[model samples]
Target chain A: MTLLAGHPTKVGRLAFVDQDYPIVLPVNFRVHRGSVVFRSDTGSKYMAAAMGQKVAFEVDDVDEAWQEGWSVLIQGMCHEITDPHQLKLIDGIGLNAWAGANMHTLEILHHRITGRRIV
Target chain B: MTLLAGHPTKVGRLAFVDQDYPIVLPVNFRVHRGSVVFRSDTGSKYMAAAMGQKVAFEVDDVDEAWQEGWSVLIQGMCHEITDPHQLKLIDGIGLNAWAGANMHTLEILHHRITGRRIV
Candidate 1:
């Protein structure tokens, strides 16, 4: 199994603006070709991708017991994978659709990633 | 210790618009009088609160072992607690400043909270 096959903290929050409302929703994601990829089923996230919106995705590992953690934030443009060749390539990336069935693949492209450690 | 004193997942992602991009940042938060409260220094979050921006906050409890979790989403207006009396009252809420010091208190007011379980 690849390290991401069953990664415990694979879930992160995807943020985007929908009609002037800033929204954040948790998503299961994986890294592919230096971008964040996830599956969504015609939801807000999917709509954001379809609209080619700029978004922020955040993932963190924290030990609340010790009050410490590090977080990585990525800002990028969302793109829905539609090309058959690319979709087939992404299918081999070992990412699962943990959210639901009938999903579409989306990736955050041109990522500007940053991380901070809270010690 | 109240349930939140050492809650393992008390940290959540606070989302709001900065410029034209939607951004989400991890925050250690607690519920105070039906509002979500956290401490932040002068940063993007602080500016959002000062502007009374409408924002969304998301917190989730996930079990990657079982691929199940529940997330609560909150939509509200961010308020910076500047009133001396209110600040003094919030000081006793027991929510630690897990990130850093010299923090200012902010709360999401008029919460419209909703939750969903993923199985």
Candidate 2:
């Protein structure tokens, strides 16, 4: 979660299978209670989450010149936060989607989190 | 391809279906003849490529302060460059995996490429 918080871009890629092929999309996200929280319209992402699909969220920082970096991968089942209480709570967390408005909240229930750091 | 070249980190996330779940792993890569090329050992990635699985590779640049960025997504079939001639040609392209030794060459045969930029 600290890595997610400290990412300079505050951006990560959300990976999920769509139409029999894996797809990764860049999303502005926040870490909430050890899970990844982000907003999106009722698009493919929301649909995927609604289906409780397993996903991988990845964030990394690399120094090209030095050839060193650290990466964190979170593998979990995605759930659309539909409960009113949870939705209100997440709204108060101050995570706004980088694009679009009236977005739906989605969370990746972190099942396995791993990190690799190279120096 | 231009975005891949100009990315400061020269890194991107490779997404593929692994064990019924989507997994995304960060990889150091370079563009060669409009395809993303990188090196890897006989790991899950190399195995996935050897199977010719469909994959998604994503790269992005974001400015937290300005709340803007551009993202490129490449949907393709992963292929291990087993042909010695192609391997030699890609080796000459000068992309080294960020870590490890005696890596195998992998390429994503471009099927579809898309990008979005928010200014």
* Highest TM-score scorer: 2
- lDDT string, candidate 2, B31-60, tens digits: 887789888866644355435788998888
lDDT of 1 by residue, A24-78 (tens): 7888887776677888776644354435888988888776668787777778888
Q: What is candidate 2's fraction of native contacts? A: 0.66
DockQ of 1: 0.67
Candidate 2, position A117, lDDT? 92
Best by DockQ: 2
Most lDDT-accurate candidate: 2
* Each candidate's DockQ: 0.67, 0.71
In CAPRI terms, model 1 is classed as medium
Off by over 4 Å in 1: A1-7, A43-50, B1-7, B43-50
Question: What is the docking quality class of candidate 2?
Answer: medium
Per-model root-mean-square deviation over C-alphas? 3.7, 2.4
